[model samples]
Target: MSGERVAVVGVGQTEHRAVRTDVSMVGLIREAAKRALADADMTWTDIDAVVIGKAPDMFEGVVMPELFLADALGAAGKPMLRVHTAGSVGGSTAIVAAGLVQSGVHERVLTVAFEKQSESDAMWALTVPTPFQAPLVAGAGGYFAPIIRAYMQRADAPDDIGMMVAVKDRLNAIRNPYAHLKLPDIDMKTVEESPMLWEPLRYLETCPSSDGACAMVLASERVADAAAKPPAWVQGTAWRSEPTLFARRDQVNPQAGRDCAADVYQQAGITNPRADFDCAEVYVPFSWYEPMWLENLGFAEPGDGWKLTQSGATAFDGDIPWNPSGGVLSSNPIGASGMLRFAEAANQVRGAAGEHQVEGARRALGHAYGGGSQFFAMWVVGADKP
Candidate 1:
C-alpha cells in the first residue's frame, strides 16, 4: 500500500549488549515487541500486521527466522513481511510497517529488527567471498579503512577527529541506560591509546558485535490519538538503493544517501538540516563516519566537516546535536542499529529520552545506510503531528 502519512506511537529496545544469551532470536524480538505494545497501552491483539528485519542469515545461523518467530512475536495468522537491506534493514523495516498504516489498510502495526551476532562471528559472516573479489579483506573494518583514510586525506582532518567522535558518543552513552558498550571511562586519551584494529580505524572506532533487538509500534491518526503519550508524527521518510558495485559511486558520500536525505528534508520542508533538525540519530559504526556523514548530510562543506566535530557542534549541548542517544558507537547491534537510530529520534521527540533528551526538541532525524553505502534510509519525525 502507498503510505501517505504515518505516526510512530511507541518505541522500545532491549538492553543492547555484546551478548544477550538469556534469550533466543525469537525471544529477543518478542521482548522488544512486548515492551512497545505495553508502551502504547495496547496488547498484541491490537496490532494489525508485523514486519521483521535483520542484516543476514549468517550472523545468527538462522535463515528465515521470522517464519519461526511468528507465533513468538504474536504475529501468527497475520500479515508478516521481512526486509533485508544489509545494515539499513531496521530503518527500512519501520518505513514498510508505517506504510501499512498510512495506506489505511491497518490501524496499528508492529515492526522489529535484531541481530544475535553472538551465535556466529559477525566479522566472518560479513567477510563472505564473492566471485572475483580479493580475499585480503578482514571484515567491515577492512573495507572501510581505506575510505576513512581517504576522508582524512581529502578533508585534511586531524587524527583527533576520530578520538573526539568516540569519546563524545561514549560519554553520551552514559546518559543512555540501554547502550551496549558502557565504557564508563571512555575519553579521547583512552581512545587515542586504544589498540588499532584496522589502519586509520582504531579499536575504539569500531562498533561492538552485539546481540540485541529494537521494536516499534506505528499507529494511524486515530490510534495515535489514544496513545499513552504524545506520539512522534512521521513527518517524512525515504529509502534509496543503488547497485552494490557502480562506477563513480562516491563511497565516501554516495548519491543514494544524499538523495535519501534530500527526499526526507524536502518532505519535512527543511531548507537547512543543520539548523532545522534539533537532534539526529545517525548510524555511525565507525567514528570517522560522523564527519563523513556530516558532509554528506549537508551539515558542512565537503572538506570542513571535521571542524564541526572539533568545535563541539555535534555535542549534546551544541546548536545541532547528533546522536545524543550514544548512537551506533555506544550500542551497535548491526541489524538493530538502524532501528535504534529511528527509535531514538522518536524518543527524543516524545521526551522519553531521560538524560539524553534534547530539551524542547520539536524535530529530529533518524538515518542509516548499508551495502557498500548503496542503500540508504532516513526519516524526519516531529513532536507535533504533521
Candidate 2:
C-alpha cells in the first residue's frame, strides 16, 4: 500500500515451553534467528538491517537487551533498530522492519521478538506499583477481569463461550509441534473443572508463562521474487495507541483497536472481514478476549461476537478459523507471541502451516494488542500480490 511491496520470505520460531532450560537468553534468540536465515536461504550479510523487540526490561532483568543481543543476531554492524510498544512490540517490530523495505530503505530486513519469562517473575514485574495507578494485584487477569465481566453483562453472552474457546485453542495446539501446551484431552468439561484464577477465567482459559522467540525475514518484491519458497505478500500494516485510563474509556472494545483494524482493512481492500480473510491469528491471552476482539476487529457486530464462537465459526474447521496455531493460550511467550501470530498468518497464506494450514488460504489477518488494550497492531497478507 506504499512505495515498495514487502513480502515475508522466511519465518522461524523456537520451541515454546514453560521454561527453556536448553538455551540461555542469547542462545534462545540465536536459535530463532539462525532458523529464519536458513529458511530465507540467506546469510547475515544478505540482510541490510535488523529490527528486534521484547517486553519490559523487568521481565528479564536486562536493560537495553538489544545492545547485548546485537552480535548474537549478527546485527552489530547493521542498522539495528529496537522497538518497544508493551506487549504489542513484536507486531510493531515486524511492521517497522517491513517499513524499511516498503519505503525502499532496505532490500532485506530481519526482525525478531522474544521473551524468557523464567528469567524473572513476569507476574511480579507486572504487579509492581506504578505511580497514580491502582496496582495489578492479580497481574493481567485481575486487571482484565472487570472488563471481561462488563462485556459479559453488556453482551449477555453464554457462560460456556469462554470454555469453548479454551477447549478449541488447546485442541488446536495439539497440531502445533512448537506450542508449549499440548493438551490433547482438553474438553469443555476439563475447562469448566479447572481452578478459577480470575472470575470467569479458569486456569485452562488463561495463557501460560513461556520462554520462546520468533523471527522473520522480510524483503522487497524483487528479493521475494527470487526466493526459493513462496512469499506471503504484505497487503497492508497499521498500528494505533491510546491512553490507558480516561473518563469512560471503552476497555471492552477500545477505539484504538477499531481504528487500527479499519485502517489496515481499508488498505488491504477488505470490505467484509468475516468473508475476505480465510483465517486470523489474534492476540487472545484470555479466552474471553477472543469474542471481545472479534467485535473490536469488526469480524462481528457489537454484542454478537460470542455468537460466532458459540456457533463454532472460530473452530479449526470453521468458516473463519481463528488462531489455528493454538495462539497465545497455548504458547504465550509474551514478547514473541505477537510475532508468532503474525508469522502464523504468513505461514497460512504461504501454504506452509503444515497441519494447521487453512486449505486454499489466499488472504489472512494477524493482530496484536497490549497495555490495557490501548496499543494495537494489525496486518493483512496474502498469497497474491496486492
Candidate 3:
C-alpha cells in the first residue's frame, strides 16, 4: 500500500568518544533524546512511539537493556520497540520509525540507537563462535581483511587508496565537534606507517570502539509542516538482506547492497546517483569500504570506485563529497554509527551541519550495511518536499 509522506524534524547525537564514563546508559540515551526533543520544539508528551536499536546485547553485557531504559526514553506509557540487526541496526531503527509515520500509524516517533563499548569487549563479543563455523577470525577486521584484499586484487586498486581515505575522513572529523577522533595531523605517511592490525588494514584504517548515542524525531507531513525548523523530506527508503555466507557470494560487492541501492534510487527518480546526490554519508567502519560501497551504491562503475577516491572526487570539496562529518572511522559507536550517517544526511539537507555542511546540498544519501555486508539499508533525503 502507498504510504503517507514522512519527514525528519529533529536530530541529535552524543559526543562520541572511547568512553562516556560521565553518564550511565539511561543518562546517555536521555541526553540525546532531550536534545532531539528540543530540536523539534516539542516535549515527551508529543511523541507517539519510540524505537531503539543496538549492535548486540553481548557487547554491552546487558540482555534486554531496553526494559530498564523505557522510563528514561519516555516510553513508559507509550509504544516502544527494540531492534537489533548487527551493524545496520541504527539505520534499520530509523526506517521503522519512518514507517510508523508513513503508514499513518504515528504522528510523531522518536528513534534512537546507541552503544557503550567500554562496558564490554566488542572484539570478544563479535568473535563469539557459532555452530558449523570455525572461529578463525579474531574480530570484524580479520573477517573483512580478506575481502578487502580480494577487492584490491580484483579492482587493481593501488595500495595507497586506503591510506587516502583514512586521511580524508580523519581530517574531515576536525570540523565535526561530536566526532571521536580529531587527527588534525593525519596524513598519508602517518596512515602508511601505523601498525597493521589486519593484513593491508592499519591501526589508523580501522574504526574505534566508541560509546555514543544518536536520536531523531520523525513526523507526518502534517506535523512537519508546522515545525520550527526545516524538515528533511524522506524521498525514498529501502532495505535488503541475504544469508551471511553462501556459495559464490560476492563479499566484495554484495547483491543485497546493490538491490537496496537500486530500489532507493528508483523510488527517488535518481537516474545517476553520482550526479543526482550532492553528498553521501555511508557506513565506512573501515577505510576501504568507502570505495567498495561507492561501487556497490552505484556511485561509480565496477573496478573503478578506487579511481574516484584516488582522484579526490569523494573529498569534501570534490564534486560529490562523502562523510563530511568524519564518518564511522572517526566515531563508530557500532549501533549508533548507521544512524549517525542518516542523521548527518538529514542535517545537510536541512542546512544545519555547521563546518561540514556541503554547499547547496539539496539532496543526499545515507547508507548502512551489517553482518558480513549482507544486510543493507539506504535512504535519500532532500530539502524540498517529495
Q: Which residue segments of model 2 deviate by more than 4 Å?
A: none
TM value for model 3: 0.99
Please give, for residues 1-386, the per-residue lDDT of candidate 1 as tens digits: 13556788888889987888798887888889888988888899888899998998899888788899989988888999999999899999988888888888898899999988898888888788888966537888888888899989989898889889999998899999888888888888788899998988889988888888999999998878877788999998899998766576688878888899888898888888898989999999999999999999989989988999999999998998989999988888898899999999998999888899999998999999986778998989998877
How do all models score by TM-score?
A: 0.97, 0.99, 0.99
lDDT of 2 by residue, 160-218 (tens): 99999999999899899999999998889999999999998999999999999999999
Worst 10 residues of 2 by lDDT: 134-143
Cα lDDT listed for each candidate: 0.88, 0.94, 0.93
lDDT of 3 at 307: 97
Q: Model 3, range 202-321, lDDT digits (tens) per residue?
A: 999999989999999999999999998999999999999998877979999999999999999998888999999999999999999999999999999999999999999999999999
Q: How should the candidates be ordered by lDDT, best one leading?
A: 2, 3, 1
As a TM-score, model 2 comes out at 0.99
Question: Which ten contiguous residues of candidate 1 have the minimum total lDDT?
Answer: 1-10
Clashing residue pairs for model 2 = none
